[model samples]
Target: MAAEETGLRVQEALDRLTGTGAREAGEDLVRELMAFYGEGLAALVGAVAPEALVPALDRPAAAGLLVLHDLHPEDVGTRIVRALDSLPRTPPVLVGHDPDSGTLTLRRAESGGGCGCGGDDEREVENAIACHAPEVTAIVWEQAPALLQIGSRPPTAAEAR
Candidate 1:
């Protein structure tokens, strides 16, 4: 699991501990650990940051940490464009990037065959953006999602030959 997934799981466990006296202990432990490690991460960012951003973003762990702390040197729009360009399949056409709201709008490419999965592509894209460019708070699809058609219906009891 990624750092984000691990943190979410830990948070869920902590929430379950609430109303039990151990909750405070868990909370304090988390706070202290975060402070200790966050300080180290900040120092590391200051010390070894590459002059170019592509290097930092190319490393998954480093990219996640930079995004978690808002220390990435690239602007939100640039990151969004880069993330889209990295997609393996037909990439979404860039509609717009709103820095003020941190929302990215994308439309389906008109020339490609549709996956017909009803926005699974969008969700995957969103997840990817969250990993590589957490600055984007939301992704809005300007085009309607493609819908998959299931195979022909199975024969009923009376319809069987």
Candidate 2:
């Protein structure tokens, strides 16, 4: 089906789920509908946001869901991460770095740790830290003064000069 048709279907399902005295019944219907259309929505998103899909394309299941619905990788990752983060305790950490630009993007990592599951979690963490090296460097630079203030004693006359 076309995107518009899919959207209309989803909207109608949502209306039925939320409309009138049968709120609970509608909610159940909405959940079922969401599960049924989730993959399609993912594919639709992927088609519109190809740049975002790059990161998720490597993962078979995630990529399949995206391809099935034409969703972007980034959107897949974002949604997955958001869902993961909402769970209680030990949220995964996502950290990205641009070395030359000295920029960092830090957020919770995906729930399942992507392909880096098992013992590789350490490596993943290290990689994230490395990616943010420039940001770390800047933070250190900014803290130097405060660190010096904390450690230094009063200067002698000769040192003051």
Per-residue C-alpha lDDT of model 2 across residues 1-161, encoded as one tens digit per residue? 46576567666767665557467656665665655678566556646755764665445455555534444334433443443343344544444434455443444344543552334544443343333221222211111112233667789999999
Question: Where in model 1 is the C-alpha error above 4 Å?
Answer: 1-19, 115-118, 144-161
lDDT of 1 by residue, 6-91 (tens): 56656765665765757675776576556556666777768864685567685767777777777776777777776777676777
Q: Model 2 residue 119 lDDT?
A: 41
How accurate locally, in lDDT, is each candidate? 0.72, 0.47
**Model number with the top TM-score:** 1
TM-score of each model, paired residue for residue: 0.65, 0.24
* Count of backbone clashes, every candidate in sequence: 0, 21
Instruction: Tell me the lDDT of model 1 at 95.
Output: 88
